[model samples]
Target: MAKPLNLLELIPKRIAKWEEVEGLVVILKPKFSHPWMREHLLPRLKKPYYRVKLDETGSSVWRLCDGQRTVEEIGKILSQNFGEKIEPLYERLSYFFQMLERNRFLNLTQKDQSSGQ
Candidate 1:
């Protein structure tokens, strides 16, 4: 997993399909964290779910992780929509993505690491 970046220039991808369940974003957890969980006991048992409830601000930011927009771009949109500056914008956004990434919700994508922009 990527560490909490000092900047938010990387692209991100959702790990799996998620759905809004009663206003919460929920993802299905595979039956097994280890292969043995599936093979030893719950081979046929249904998978459980992981739900993340987002407040207004988090929901707005979460909705923007469409696997295409760079985190910086999303920060700009947040600035425009909210009509105020998000100082240390990239750092905050990077932390958000890093949390999600660590929890297996998403991952960042970067093609050009040398771009200092």
Candidate 2:
């Protein structure tokens, strides 16, 4: 049997700071550590890092990560926002989320049990 989808896992949310720089909105976490710190310094440096550029759609999705909403919720919202072109919206949003996770722009957290109000 195929494994059941974990709703929380599928649409995890995280807190991130957003900035508009050079005509692009950048998303980043304030606590990410540098890879070269431990080897170069006696005490590892824990400076803030900003490395991801948020496109229009990405900026929209990033704005929705206000400690609320699930992946499914965001997907539905995007679907409605895009109307007949929902598939592309869904695909883009999913791709953006995956990229953010991979680049450590934010840390994914399980959705709370309570449905968003």
Candidate 3:
């Protein structure tokens, strides 16, 4: 029988890809709200379409999430690349993944993720 997957193993891929603009990698922020708000409040707010901009580290991680590497593998790469700069690696990485998942940014491969909040 196969062993059940852990949290890290469950998050084995990212399907939300980013586009490169000049030297920066960016994802377009989708506007979601009532049509009235979109036609009214959004224009007045003047929010940029590409709201979430990844920094150097985030961009690196985003690139590494190519649907084959597990979260642990990504963590190892981060450790090697960043060295001692990012302490408590798993916590930070997990939180980052969770944030991405929460914001509907990451497309994880977990079976139940579709119904997740």
Candidate 4:
């Protein structure tokens, strides 16, 4: 049986490529699921992909999830950058990550609980 995942040890990685638009993170979600459709039909539309604009904190989290940093490390960085404004940090981070995962925006890997990142 598999062990339960530790929130701190989970590493988040972005699945979709993103860009900075006016200092905010804008994720591009492909409109078509199949490659053939994307190639043959996507170009016909004015907008190729869905542009998901993230808020300041979400943008910061999105930028940090480069497949390297663990959730704990991200929380530490956010705490340092946002201070009290990000009170109740871990809970919010967990929710944010869950939502991202549910929406297929990012993927999470469970780091060994005994290992140090």
Candidate 5:
């Protein structure tokens, strides 16, 4: 029997952010309260932690998470947007999705079918 499709196996299209540091775009999810924030804030407020060091492809994948697109949808978008006709789009997307999942940056949540909010 064929393996069931795991929605969580797809790349996250949300909760991902990226910023360029030293010419390399670092992708990460910012924490709401970082441990080190107490030292920097005048009132000792907690800062969010940031996970950095994402590659160019990872960064690209992160940008596609607009809440409306799914893994299959993203593959199509990437292929069309980047003009990647020769290469396999789904395979590449799956690779990046796996990487993001391993890093704990992407969270898989059930899609709300009703109201589509």
Candidate 6:
């Protein structure tokens, strides 16, 4: 039997590369799901990719998810920057990560047990 994952120990890695515009994070996702549609229809649209814009706090969180930091570490960073604004941080952070993962925005992987850090 496999053990359940510890939320704080999981590392969230961004699946799609994003860009920052006016201090906001913009996730550029391909509009078409099929390769044929993308090749044919994507060029016809005004924009090839769908831009998912994120708010200031969200942008900060998104930037911090670089595959290296665990959820706990991200929470600490958020606490330092947002302080009281991010009160009840862990619950909200967990929800945000869950939502992102469900939407295929990120991949949460288990931290390596062998690497002593």
Model 1, span 18-113: residue lDDT tens: 777666555555545676765776656555444466655566677788877888788889878775455566667778778888878787887455
Task: Flag regions of model 1 displaced more than 4 Å.
Answer: 1-6, 22-24, 27-32, 38-47, 85-88, 112-117
lDDT of each: 0.69, 0.62, 0.71, 0.92, 0.61, 0.91
TM-score of 2: 0.59
lDDT rank order: 4, 6, 3, 1, 2, 5
lDDT of 5 by residue, 1-117 (tens): 986766533435555556677656676554544546534652443434465775655556676666666777666766776775526777676676777777666754446659663
Q: What local lDDT score does residue 21 receive in model 1, on the 0 to 100 scale?
A: 61
Minimum summed lDDT over a 10-residue window in model 4 is located at 108-117
Which regions of candidate 6 deviate over 4 angstroms?
none
lDDT of 3 at 100: 82
The global Cα lDDT (0 to 1) of model 1 is: 0.69
State the lDDT of candidate 2 residue by residue for 37-92, as single tens digits.
53465245455454578665566667666556777777777667667754666567
Q: Please give the distance, in angstroms, between residue 111's alpha carbon in candidate 5 and its true position after superposition.
A: 2.6
Candidate 6 residue pairs that clash: none
Model 1 residue 48 CA deviation in Å: 1.0
Error of model 3, residue 70, in angstroms = 0.3
Rank by TM-score (best first): 6, 4, 3, 1, 2, 5
Writing each residue's lDDT as its tens digit, candidate 6 over 18-54 gives 8999999998888887999988999999988889999
User: What lDDT score is found at residue 4 in candidate 5?
Assistant: 73
- For model 4, state the Cα shift of residue 101 in Å: 1.5
